[model samples]
Target: MSAHSPLPSHELAIRVRALQVGFGTRLVLNNLELDVRRGEVLGFVGGSGTGKSVLARTILGLVQKRAGRVEVFGEDLDQLSKEGHRAMERRWGVLFQHGALFSGLTVLQNVQVPMREYLSLSPILMDELARLKIALVGLKPEAADKYPSELSGGMIKRAALARALALDPELVFLDEPTSGLDPISAAEFDELIKTLQQTLGLTVFMVTHDLDSLYSVCDRVAALADGKVIATGTIEQMLAAEHPWLRTYFHGTRASRLTLARAQSTGA
Candidate 1:
């Protein structure tokens, strides 16, 4: 229930209170409460099937909540009209776990999808803006013409990220952005995320299991267990937690090696 010292409501980008979600008889999230502050990367982690993605989806209004309040940019989601909800959606972007680019569309077309839906710009303008987003994400101009089938895994992630940024959103939700890449590629992607988040002044809510990404990019981390956030703090605080799961997850053999490597790298 405790988290990093909270920001005032005006400084929060997304807030969830007293959330409860269930499927049939099984409750996935029970009385979950979370806050995402503006202009920071908040990493959300949990064991597999622990409703991490569900929380993100519920906030985005993709899944129905049994009971709760979700507020984005200070407006309660339940209070918005259909038109108002659509407007609220324009303020955020999402990069799903897998690059959800359309198989039939080129990268440029895929990036233009949001623009086409949310804007009334001419085709030429849309094309130009889409190219700019592609370039912004570190993809080559030539990659704009390629289909998702033509990209490397890393390239696909970038292309998906470009599409996510198509609307120039203020808040972004990233689901396992580095999941499929090799170590080198994952590190590079993490750097790109950190850079873009800073440059764009974005509030990011990221659902991920990658320890390296947590260390390299996140400003704060929240861990979920038993259908609620069990702990929230810096990596060092998480490592020092007394909870059994936290003890096991952060001090296990692999994590010990990572900690040792980090200390050695920093000459700590």
Candidate 2:
């Protein structure tokens, strides 16, 4: 149908219906359904291996679905032609876990990878765009020339994010964006994500476990369990949920302490 030729008219940027995925004898996602709305930051949460990343990979067409319909920008992925698939890919970006930057490449070269793959531009222009993206993610210009090994944890994240933003994508898939950071650095990264989301009008599909990220940046949160989405709502709504996992997750000791501390600080 060549759905990529013209953008479809719909509120959803990504939709999954009756999805099933597995490895060998183990099932990962079963009859899972989800929707990421246009221009909204949707936080996807799950325990260590409940298939949050699997679902995201399925939507990105990185994982094969056994039985399901997956759509992005209103185009059914199963129906897209090769060229159509490439066109769809151009409209989105992804930040894999641990930044996944090439250990050998400088931040600038890493950020230019996508541009080099999907675009045909002069080296000068690519350099300029990559630097702009690095700056956009709050990295200083000098950091662009550093390799991933030489950068701090936060800088690695920012550098990878610059690569994700390289194509000026309308949709961004972030896997554990705040993982491996100190609390303060994590908070700062969350703020940067929020600012970029607002400034770019981006639809962000973030797979994360950070409660602070959920509370501060996500417009809505979806929790995965039993290979399906068990609950979806704001942080407040999640906190109020009575589901066993939700209750333990949101009201457990660490979560409770965070909530209480926020309350006390606000009162002061």
Clashing pairs in 2: none
What lDDT score is found at residue 176 in candidate 2? 97
Error of 2 at 83 (Å): 0.7
Report the lDDT tens digits of candidate 2 across residue range 1-268: 1112132448889877788999998889888877778898999999998888888888988898899899898889999999999999889999998889999999999999999999999999999999999998889999999999999988998899999999989999999999998998899888988998899899999999998898889998899999988888778888888899999999989899999988999999
Could you tell me the C-alpha RMSD of candidate 1 in Å?
Answer: 1.5
Residue-wise C-alpha lDDT for candidate 1, range 1-268, written one tens digit per residue: 3953468787999888999999999999999989889999999999999999999999999899999899999999999999999998899999998888998999999999989999999999999999999998888999999999999988998899999999989999999999988999889888988998889998889999899998999998899999998998888889889999888888889888998999999996
lDDT of each model, Cα atoms only?
Answer: 0.91, 0.89
- Candidate 1, poorest ten consecutive residues by summed lDDT: 1-10
Q: What is the lDDT of candidate 1?
A: 0.91
Backbone atom clashes (below 3 Å) for every candidate: 0, 0
